[model samples]
Target chain A: MSGRSERVRGKLSYAEAIREALDIAMDRDERVVLMGEDIGVYGGAFQVTGDLFGKYGPERVIDTPISELGGAGVAIGAAMTGLRPVFEFQFSDFAALAMEQIVNQAAKLRYMLGGAVSVPVVMRFPAGSGTGAAAQHSQSIEAWLGHVPGLKVVQPSTPEDAKGLLLSAIEDPDPVMIFEHKLLYKTKGHVPRGHYETPIGEAALRRIGHSLTIVATSIMARKSLSAAEELARQGIHADVIDLRSIRPIDRETVLASVRKTGRLMCVYEGVKTLGIGAEISAMVAESDAFDFLEAPIVRLGGAECPIPYNPELEKSVVPQEPDILEAARNLVQGRI
Target chain B: MPVEVIMPKVDMDMASGKILAWHVSAGDEVSKGDPLFDIETDKAAMEVESPGDGILRFPVDEGAVVQIGRPVGWIYADGEVASDPPGGIPSSKDEFRQSVPGEATADGSRNNISSGPDNISGKFRASPLARSLARADGFEIATIVGTGPRGRIEAKDVRNYQARRESEADTSDALAVSESASGTGTPIILLHGFASDAKSWTRLESNLGQRPLVRMELPGHGRSQILKAVGFPDLAATVRQTFDGLNLDKAHLIGHSLGGALLLDLANARPDLVASLTLIAPAGLGPEINGELLAGILRATRSESLGPWLKKLVADESLVTESYVQAAMRDRMEQSTRAAQEAMADALFPDGVQAFDLRAALARVEVPTRILWGKQDRMIQWNHALRAPGRVAIHLLDGIGHMPQIEAPEEVARIIEANL
Candidate 1:
């Protein structure tokens, strides 16, 4: 029924898709460069870069010292001078150390310089919990960068989108931030061969239904899709929207779905307070879709606390598939 | 650059404002501080003044729920070419407007209710959508029992309430039919056309005095219950049951349009109950029908849109009075009644093609049958009367449209008397 399912060739893990994207970009353009801490020799903290360092050599794939602020600044400066730099954060939590470069410099350089110099830099963040990395290393801080206007933030749930969106992010003129959920790196799915760009700022409709709309971001989108499958078995169908991008949010897709389903539930792994769910909930409330809501809008996000070291506590910190199932069932059955 | 007209932040805590109405349309010259539009905030509805004098170009339609400080329109200065709003044109302009009628007024009521924690103030805990649906369908939300968390009223609750109310109305109507059947002689049962009720036969009924008369309201019309019949046979059976319930051995059946088609089916099914048949511009003769006119009537929500179609029912437009238009509008006000009529129209006449063939029903008639047609009838053409058998009587009235009863009541009454 969907053209996306028909276009697939073979299966690849989400981590492999990112590696292939970097390989294709480097071969296509000499201006493309990779910069990060332990990305060259150690083959990335999560092994996403893999043997790309050996394929591209050290000149193209350069590893930096343990200074995120300094490394990010250098990448942003190289982007202004025409080189396409793909920077990876060892963990998304360390993005806090480079906030001065990402938030102020990379986000506002072009607008501040009267649109003379464009930043074509792409940053990959290994975000989310369930790895027992504790609060310091395992955190989803994509929302912080997403709040900045000049930056384009994306979270690809599927391997196809991971490859397609990464390629597109490399091609984007503005500084793009790609938040790769650590849990989704090993998950495998059919990835379309060659260079394909899943346009950023557009939300993908994973499942179509009329009972309600479930808008989920990053890894939460995967969990929501599974929950939707269970809901369908119970005769409670929901439109599952995988919000691949968050910065230039897909307001139209979300609004259109909410209008059809007459209910909305935003599921994300970010902190519940001012996370992506809050923005989405507010966006619907302020749009015409508000009138179509049959039930109260729901938000099932990460608990308002740091990620714990214990595996059980870590799972409880963020929303799981069961959480999505219960919330969707309640919203659709009008229990909430 | 044109001065951008934004949805002003009226209240300190207001996140969005709904533009109730645009006082000035596009391309209108406006001065600074002139009333451009009225916006409804959470607290109150207030008129927002124009920021600069220019030609107002509303990129956004009225009733749009816009975020505070977002530009809803742009005021182009003299000799300055117009441009799109910075936010670009919204794909669906009127999507946010309330689908319900008579509730668009800015009466300080919440223009758009939110499911937020702050909006919960009434005795019930209904969802915003549930409240809107109930209000639109003319149901009091307080009366609806909630099935949501903490006894919150959900949209499904409102829908269940409507279904229960319709069934209750149906039961009372059945009682009224049996109780009202008190006449002595063979009764003249009159059935109305599609989208019409028993009240439509009032003009013809007054002329048939001293004769036992029974005005039967078809399902989905007047006070009758809505019947979701499978086919024409099922619809005919329903009318037949109503006749049988009256304890009448036989009835002189008179039907018009859709009603005529049903009576023909009834006579074909149970010839004993039908003493005689008077079909007036009835459906089922051919596939041809004025489906556009039928659709226009069903879609019309106000008198202005409905009056034109009602005027086509008669050759003389004067017969389609203001009261007639208002009466039809009032009938359509009930959501269930309108829905039932639409379902019937789609089943009987799909895409203007009559779904049934009653030529055999007319040919196999054992009893006396009369067909009335108007020369100026624009609904079902008069040519259909030519299909009638030689044994049947055919009367084609001059200067008349679909409705011979309203245009030439005396003539229609005389023809029915001849059949009797």
Candidate 2:
């Protein structure tokens, strides 16, 4: 394990890293099974779970009905019986159909049961839009799940993180929801091909800077980093944190970084109103971190309107790197 | 030798037990079955007996949560005899000396910290001050190595280096902007997208704030002269004449979407007028445009019709306001605006496929180009934005979609500001 950590090599896409993580986890634990729609024979819509069915066989790599609710129920049931189950939603948008099973049941089961049973379930969902999937298939709704009390929500931006966080989620005794961005699936990053874990409820500092701390999740993390690069050209260093897990949020990591930077900008694909940004902003406000903030916590997100079909209008709705960079500039300059 | 003591699992649901009380401190000798400490679980508080007859070393303080089957305190057995039963407690030093491989080290080094650098990539670390300063100054730490403690770089180093470079460049930029202001150069013109008007450029316009600026709503978009029937070429012609009407041969053209596509067409048709082209995730590149979003833009007669569709463009839906949707529908209601949207949607994206492939057209242009795209662009993939002319530079902004110029106007302005 130590040898693998020291052996840094070429770049790998986010998809490859996730696959490697799944492969290692399955190999290490026989009880770890992956079940979802088209996950077995189809290898998933985005191909994030490519070719797992053949290796793990039908029992471990079970494919359920077209029902998102049914699949979630099955996973939850399996978890209650001592098996570790990883459920996948064809699209995160479909999670709305399974809200009762997820928010009401999977999330509250362990806590409400007086800790008698542990829900070691990991549900993976493809979230966000960029492929012209439009309103039905697009949308970033992780904030909704994060709002649930007992659920642990995670969004891994990088391949290595996808692998580490997935392993961690599998090991956790409580239910964990993993929101994977559609655009990031094909993106590659180097990943260790062994059992590893990134502790849940911790944020990873992707890029270090002081002018402003850009707290982002899932695909937004990549955008924040890109904006950080652009900001660097302008002589503004933006510290970026990938809040991998939304619920059980690593408040310590976010607050510590914000305390140093004195400025905070929360970026995400979700709408600004009642979105993840609001929660983060409130978290900062409620903590001592608020005193350290030099500027108001700025949130860069999708326009509060329906995503337009016109290519031009669609581009205008969501938060972009240029938007992030510009927001950072304004915050650093006290413009906002 | 050090002996291990673990919090007993008092109940089945009890995952972690807390240390309620400690009877002895470090260096204290202990015998088998000695009452070491009191543990508290979700059920109740119970006394825990020592595992070995040795010096006690309680690492965790009272009120620390410990997992079952995991050692919480250590004891030195010295050379004792085996007497305690398996379920009773510890017996002798040899009996307690059984080492569990891969268990946490006795030094408490592996607690809470990361297990190891398993899949983490690259050595991207810097001091908190250095990171903040670097971000503030827009410096990329990956390009520089640290010299501080543990090879971590400090913010002062970044500031010193940045100050030197900015001073050298500030002199030249000031002189150029001043020269342009003195009538040596023409004003910059910014074009807004459909349903959006000149106000979209307010952020960037204010930033370039210095140069004389002219912003117009395209025939079907803002307050510009509305058109009856508009297409890409028609919009391009109007934009070209708009520059002509302003009495300027060529000014910097910064456009978003329809504006961007129009600018590209104009730059291709008359390369001499355009000093540079800044395209914000412009269309006319890919054939895989989202038809549903386009249909929503055209059929949206009211906010109810347009709200959900508009929200699809961004990951966040709050940006979609009833007023914003109403304004979009109102713009589309205009006879000319409706025709223009229909014609452009058909001409640019015909039957769910992009009709125009401007890569070849852009290849013939010689103007310096800068392309900006949102990674989350739902209408046209950022991949299409990369099809600029050979010399054109591309910046893919994540979390944005087709109309980053509006969703992130300030960002569009900053990128343009940097280019200027």
Candidate 3:
């Protein structure tokens, strides 16, 4: 095969890619619709909706009042009727307000109806802290929804993944949660043009290494990558697997890396206890990877407290590059 | 001719066998039916006789656990020279080839070499500065090919591999171009399918008769550039350039599975470069494909790992030799091979369904085309043969499966010669 280096094309901001996905799904299928607070007229809290209000008009891109629960209920109801509705949450923490509609109705309805009805609803939560939106505005609540059986939880780390995952989330048979890290909005990366699904339940191997495997999600996945770079500086090579889909979590890829590295490090901005890391840690501990472990599995998650209003404290409360580097070093060295 | 003495399938369900002992050394002479090696299967320990009279060649040392159908050694008969098997498998220098798997020395483990800031010994042959920089960045120092004195992985090689800086070399030559086809006989371009290389066309090589062919290893397959992130069009363009690189304006194109679709696109993209087209159970004509086979070959580290998948390639499971399986596995271990293969597979057959429907393209092509398919093909349906244009020829062999070249090489080679 001719080995010409792959040419990078079509750079897009994370926000632009999400909006592009919305535009693509709507243009391709008449049944696809967008509904959120100010998403139609004001262009959303984060403006991820873009100018869809003017393009697709009011009926297709409906603007709703500030009622996450009510709007979520309507979206779930619309999904039951086979109209693909992508409901937007102003922030992920707001998902707590719509737990009844999202978890109980949208998620369980497919099985609850014995496969007679499907709720193909996609919910986008502008998640994670970086804009100093404090606890309410900047929470990554994927874990809360990930714990539920029927709902698919995901956190797209780049612009490319954001667009592809959003489109796939729209076509899902059940509710798929898209937790877009707030800070990643303006970050630019090459996004493939056209409709393509970055298949859910598959972890993206960001980089390869042999010393350890760092399982990271959302913003933490990027931070862990930088941290992995630092680890490589001292000759510590690590395999960084971006847990794009938290639910149906790709256990095969995780186990495979752990089998090679003999060390595991879970990196996420969620709370340390009962977060995604705990599940991943338990997955390895429960699997054959436990016997091959050179060091105890390490989870560099958020502290056991709500994210603070103070920016410095907020940064300290969650895992960062330095924290990931330190933890990876310790794990690789068997210092744990 | 050197004959590979494989780990015989002692039982109907035998998975693997361990070597009890080898009576001969690397260059020792042996004869047919002689006591060659002692093997221990789950059933019992038995002596394996020589398959041919030749000098014994051990691919691995004693005490190695080999898959049920693995070629542990070879026998080069008198009056015949021993060469690498017909398949284009690169010679392996795997540490395990000299010892048993899981045999770790006190110095360090062969399977898992420690890297990062924690362990960069001088014996590793990496520059201290490059090692330090790589550790600080967490980039793979081993993945970077060294260009310094004695092939030391200098700071620049690591930088280049990372694409941190661009230079004269294309991404592997822009990143360029695999094994030289015998001689400049006739530059016939042969493209293999996913998880396959130029070597898959081995059986046809002898019978092709004086036609110089460039048996191209598909990216991620053999000694070609591993474009881990290339798309179908880019791949087609690369093949088109292969014609130019060989200074051939046009040549006969033969592709299998994914390669079949690729050649079609090349003919569509640049018909002048492709004189004639021969597709073997090609993809893009239908959506059906074997998901398990793709997954099996991609994940297999050894021949055993490819057992079930290799068997699905043909109607007769017995044709799936240990040497063939090892050859497939060998090409798989090519550099950036895993990433390249995975990317191509995901693009071409996402969710086990062939992504593109080339039927429309087939109807457009004016080139002389022949679609060869095995009626019993379990990978891609032979019914896809019906999609061929009226002008295009079709041959559906009754007994073969996905691989028509390996099963009916004589017929296939004759078809190529006729097309030429």
Candidate 4:
């Protein structure tokens, strides 16, 4: 006897993949919950949670008070108990308010408890700029949470990762912070139909090369991958490490590639100073991998300034694909 | 010359302050410290002061939101002739061009703040002050993890959270060790040799296969930079501290060489903490030790030279990887590590002879004790296995060296698992 053919292929937006994950999780486990502002009847600000309220009803798909702190606290409380809550922030910019609940409480509770209690919570933030939401609304803060301890921070650059990581995050015993790039919500990709769990804290080698290791996360990962493809045309082979999970970051994978290429350029959309690049640079410095580095670790991040409202100024603020290619060229040539 | 009057980061977390009302309009002369405008922040509303004595050339309207550290208006200092306004509205043009709300200003340049998500309404709602301050200083509010009431992105939350996050990231990145441990068995305590920590047992620990084990630095290794003259008493104190920190009442004790000796010391000092003892070619059993090997271990300068010395402890030379040797060398070079090693070598193996002959202590140890010895052990002679008390069990492996725990982990684990 053969198993029933159940594989269904369909084109779904990034937003839809996330919604489906929540839907599947809620369906399988009644303990799963959804909490965020305007995530109820309004179907969420971006409509990523469309009709979830109607399907799961009000208790599971809760519309929390207009307080990020309060909502995060409630989610954490529920997670500490038995339920798995997927808390959402209308925008990633709003994640700033819930830092204490996230960084101090949720991220640390497990380690502090000596792994006695498992915190299975998933906090979602809509990140990135490109829809011209201006300064306050259009920002990518994945790098911030990725720096915290106890918390597993993940950025799904593709629909498949979004679905897979979301499932993994919801099922995880520790707290997980998921950053969904705003521009990527509408972008479509192939998402397998099944309950799949993507390994957290592992870097995905998107495009393999031997010239330079481009360590990128979140939206910048896609940008770096594109830049690597473009650089490949000019004979500059750039290996791209898509850091799906930032905290407990896959240093082994990054170091392995850096050791082979002998060069590294960490590219992220966050500001340059203490961005992900700094962490990667310090990792290279502390490891035996440092001796293998032929070129100085290069960091290409957003300009050290607030994002601009003007289209031209906004474009200038962040490192685009071309900027990454230029940096990669310079790094491989020993220019910095 | 126009003296630009920029808004300041009034509150600790304020990124942008909205201009509730511009007190002085175009052509209005204002003195230093004079109320120029009423700015409102997420925290509270406050008035901005004029920087100098001059005509108040305001470019932005009364209700405009001005960013922190952005020139909102200009004060023409006495005797300094004002240049022609770039945008035409004389009094307002200087302020407008110089502090055109969102125009890049010099109050605090190069502030890169990460942005947040796209607005579903297609319109982002932020105070005017936040917008202008963000633009001028280049602050991305998105990168800041806010602690505001309701997740409202505030300026103070951004700065504080950023600093905290950066510090945390720096610490973790600097200390890069694989954190996750795999295993599903009772907790086992693995102690390291002299000048080494739990990391030395990383390979053996991985091979143990699903047993909750915690490998920690002995007194002066890894994070435990303890300083005390290395002796059985000092080693016992370090082991006690580790057990208290981990809240472990009883654990299966596994130690290699110096660590093995330390385990015996712990058992002799506080027999209650040890569930069972697995000593891999321990030091306290025999009076006979290789003086040349002990001296070589203490004086080896380069990792290359030390590699062969370390290989002598293990039956299998394959266990001595370049990275492993480098890690050992690095640990050996630490001030605390060096001190601990020298003190331990002197205390345990003074004059290249076992300092504490624990044959009597072995008789008193009620806990089931097992000792494994390598026949070809170069560090400590294998004949020590025969010196164990009548009650203690001893296993002698042919061709195995001093570090059987690392070289012959499978056999050692099988012996440990049987006891567990």
True contacts kept of 1: 0.44
TM-scores of the candidates in the order shown: 0.54, 0.45, 0.45, 0.45
**Candidate 2 per-residue lDDT over residues B157-251, each given as its tens digit:** 35534643563454311101111233234566677665566766655555564666667566545544334345566666666665555556777
lDDT per model, in order?
0.81, 0.72, 0.76, 0.73
- Candidate 3 residue-wise lDDT at B133: 62
| Predicted candidate 1 versus true structure: per-residue lDDT over B230-311, tens digit per residue | 3576677777776666777888888999889888887877787789999999999999999999999998866678889999
Better of 1 and 4 by lDDT: 1
For model 4 chain B, where is the 10-residue window of minimal lDDT? B112-121
lDDT tens digits, residue span A1-336, model 2: 367546767777887787777888888888899988898888888887889898989989898999988989999999999899999888999999999899888888888899898789999988887778888788888888888888989999988888899999999988999988989988887776568898888899989987789999889899889889977655567889999889888899899998888788899888777788878988998887765665456777777766666667777778888888877887775444
- Using TM-score, give the best candidate's number: 1
* lDDT per residue (tens digit) for residues B250-365 in model 3: 67788898889888887787777667888988988988888877887777755666777889889988999777665566556432467667777887778888877888889888
TM-score, candidate number 1: 0.54
Tens-place lDDT per residue, model 1, A1-336, is: 359756755689999999999999999999999999999989999999999889989999999999999999999999999999999999999999999999999999899999999999999999989888899988988889889999999999999999999999999999999999999999999887778899999999999998889999988999999989987656568899999999899999999999899989899888876778879988998987887787767888777678889999889778888888888887775555
What CA RMSD would candidate 3 show? Answer: 25.1
Provide the clashing-pair count of each candidate structure: 0, 65, 28, 27
- Give the least accurate 10-residue stretch of model 1 chain B, judged by summed lDDT: B95-104
Winning model by lDDT: 1
Per-residue CA lDDT of model 4 for B1-420, tens digit only, reads: 476566566544455666678787878878889988888888888887787888866346666654454456667666656564422332222222221222222333432121111122222333222333445557664444322221233333334344445535654212111223666645787776665566667567666767778775665556553344467766666666555656667778887777787677777767887788888888777778887787787787557777888877677887788777866776664332455566667877889888777777777888999988889898788888888877788899987877776677787777777877
DockQ of 4: 0.01
User: Scoring each candidate complex against the real one, what DockQ results?
Assistant: 0.15, 0.01, 0.01, 0.01
